[model samples]
Target: MIKKSMLVEKITRRTIGFVLTMLILSIGVFYLSRLAPGDPLQSFYGDAIESMSTEELDAARIRLGLDSPVYVQYVKWISNAFQGDFGLSLKYKMPAMAVITPLIGNTLILGGIAYILVFALATLLALFCAMHEDTLIDRIICKVGTAAYYIPPFWLGVVLVLIFSVNLGLLPSSGAYSVGKSDDILNRIQHMILPLVVMILSHLWYYAYMIRNKLLDEIRKDYVLLAKAKGCTKTEIVLKHCFRNVAPTIVNIMAISIPHVLSGTYIAEAVFNYPGIGALSVQSAKYHDYNLLMLTVLITGVLVIASSIIAQSVNEVIDPRIKLMEESP
Candidate 1:
């Protein structure tokens, strides 16, 4: 009962924190959108804002509600954004949702696949190395993981493109699909293979090494020794004792990695020309599409902050030590 109550308190705190974070970020987004030096009209319609007729200019401002006071504009925007409307894109000349929807879908697909693969493979490999600490296999895995982790992501992407797409010609060099004409699972996977591999290879090593180190340290705890003394099997001790204990750390690492992985996808997207949010974000930055850039940043920031809060709440729940430490006299 006490544990349930504590868990409820933790979830309530995290939920409140997430709402506060999104509110703050939305305000920041609104203010930052107004701060862009060049007008979106100039950037989108060519730098002839003064030459544009009153009708044309008013039409443009009206389209974006830019004619309103900043606070009023922000209030309306917050209302619409809550309803999943981000207004029209100045550059794309379509609803911002229209321009962003497919790209967001692509990003979620790629990011989700890579994150699951990285985390699962990293956890398994780390467990193996931790179990075999100080052995030849451990040394080799550690060295290789360290080396892979330190290499630049773009460099890895390039090398992957060169080998799989260029040299082998086995996969599409740059695209989310092969000209978008088929729904065959095999064809879709073939198109997905290169970018997915690039993402996994670029990220898996660092997480593997971190988890391995943490699990190794955790395996030496007195509780683990006591579990072993009770005649628990090796798998039981590692799985139930060590893995459960380290799960919170893994969650924390994943929460921190979410933002980075989101940003880092841009390199892979740029290399492969995949139609994901990362590529879209880069285009927005280059073209100075303040609205699109702000929207992307705002959304990504909310997800990252929410994940962080969730991780913290999970930490508080799983590790009663934290609550106790905080409550110490």
Candidate 2:
């Protein structure tokens, strides 16, 4: 009963914390949006905007509620957002959600696939390097991971496009799909390959190196030594003891990587012209589309909070001591 009560209390606190976090993020983003240079109206009228008189520009600001004080605007925005209204996109001149909703699925597919591949490849490489220690393979893995770590994603992406798409004519260079092509599963996969590879390569090296170092530290612990003395083979010790002990750290690292993954997704999508949130984000920024940009910021903020909550929950389950420690304060 006490444990149940503690669990309920923890969840309640987390809920409140997440709400506060979102609120603060919304406020910050709102202010920053105001600070961004250029009038949103310019996106609509371009240089022709100069022909409009001062009164007309003021009327346009009034229509968009941009003439209001910042705090009032924030209150209106937050209130409407709570009710599933994010206002209209200044650039697109349509409801913001109408523009954002479809692009979300594309981002999920791209980010999800790359995320899974990164973890899988990193885990295998880390395990191999850990088991091999200072052998030739371990040295090579370290060197390769270090090199990959320093290679910028944009440059790597451009190089891959030149090789695979331009020179070899093997893959589509840009966009999510071949226009007017049948939307078959195989066709979708072909379009996804290059961007997916870029995303995976950008993240894989850091994670693999981190896991290898952590595993090496775990292998030297007393528990691992005891297991070894108890007739456990190196593989058995690593698989049964070392991995379990390192699991919480791995989960924490993965959680921290969520934002980086999102940011990388944006860059990758832009480079590949994939019609995901990242590409939309670029357009939104270019046009000073406040509503679309705010919506994007809200979604990204929610994902970060969600990832953190998930990591905390996983840590608690992996070792109840974490729950106890958290509950203590």
Candidate 3:
């Protein structure tokens, strides 16, 4: 009964946290976007804004609800948002959510694949380096990974385009799909390759290095000492004891990595011209598309916050001590 109560309390706290985060994110993005130097009228009315008289401009402002005070605007927005109405995209001239519905999938595809591959490869790379220790291979990996991690993702992306897309003519350089092949799975994969290369190369080593260090730290613990005194080999202790205990730390790393990997994913989209939320965000910001921009930022914020919560839950499962500690008197 106590366990159930603790579980309920945890869920309640997490749920409240998620709601508050979205509220703060929405307010920040909304206020900042409005305060930024730009005529949102230009976004909605395009060149028509240039020709409008004062009366017409005021009418336009009134029509779009931009004539109100900032707080009043926010209140209206938040109230409508709760009812599943996010308003029309000023630039796109459609419901903001409608504009996002299609493009989000591409981002998910790129981000999901990159997220899985990065963690999986990082773990394997960490394990290899951990097992190798101070060998020549380990030193080489450390140097190469550090260098790769430091290279700006956009510049690396450009170079990849020059090599494989321009010089060798091997891969599609931009866009999520070739013209008239939206549903072609193989073609979609081809488009994803270069962006994936950028995303993975940018992030692969950062997590790997951290995990490698964590594994090494775990290897030095008292339990590992006990295992060693029991005649366990280095490999046996690392695989059986060290790595097992480090699973919670690895989960934590993965949780915090959402934002890191997401930034890389956005960079990949912008560089590759992928028709994902990243590219859309760039467009929205450039055009001062207020509704579209807010929705996009909120979506991104939710992913990051939710990942942390999910990681906490996973850690509770992997190491029950986490739950007991949090729930203790």
> Judged by TM-score, which candidate is best?
3
- How high is the CA lDDT of each candidate model? 0.79, 0.89, 0.93
Worst 10 residues of 3 by lDDT: 2-11
Residue-by-residue lDDT tens digits, candidate 1, 245-268: 898889989989997777667777
Clashes (candidate 3): 0
Q: Among these predicted structures, which one has the highest lDDT?
A: 3
> Which runs of model 2 end up more than 4 angstroms from their true locations?
none
lDDT of 2 at 14: 93
Q: Whose TM-score is higher: candidate 2's or candidate 3's?
A: 3
Over 30-139, each residue of candidate 2 has an lDDT whose tens digit, in order, gives 89878988888997667878999999999988988989999999899889998999999988889989999999988989998898889889988999899999999889
Off by over 4 Å in 1: 1-14, 47-64, 67-69, 227-236, 306-329
Candidate 2 residue pairs that clash: none
TM-score of each: 0.83, 0.97, 0.97
Error of 2 at 31 (Å): 0.1
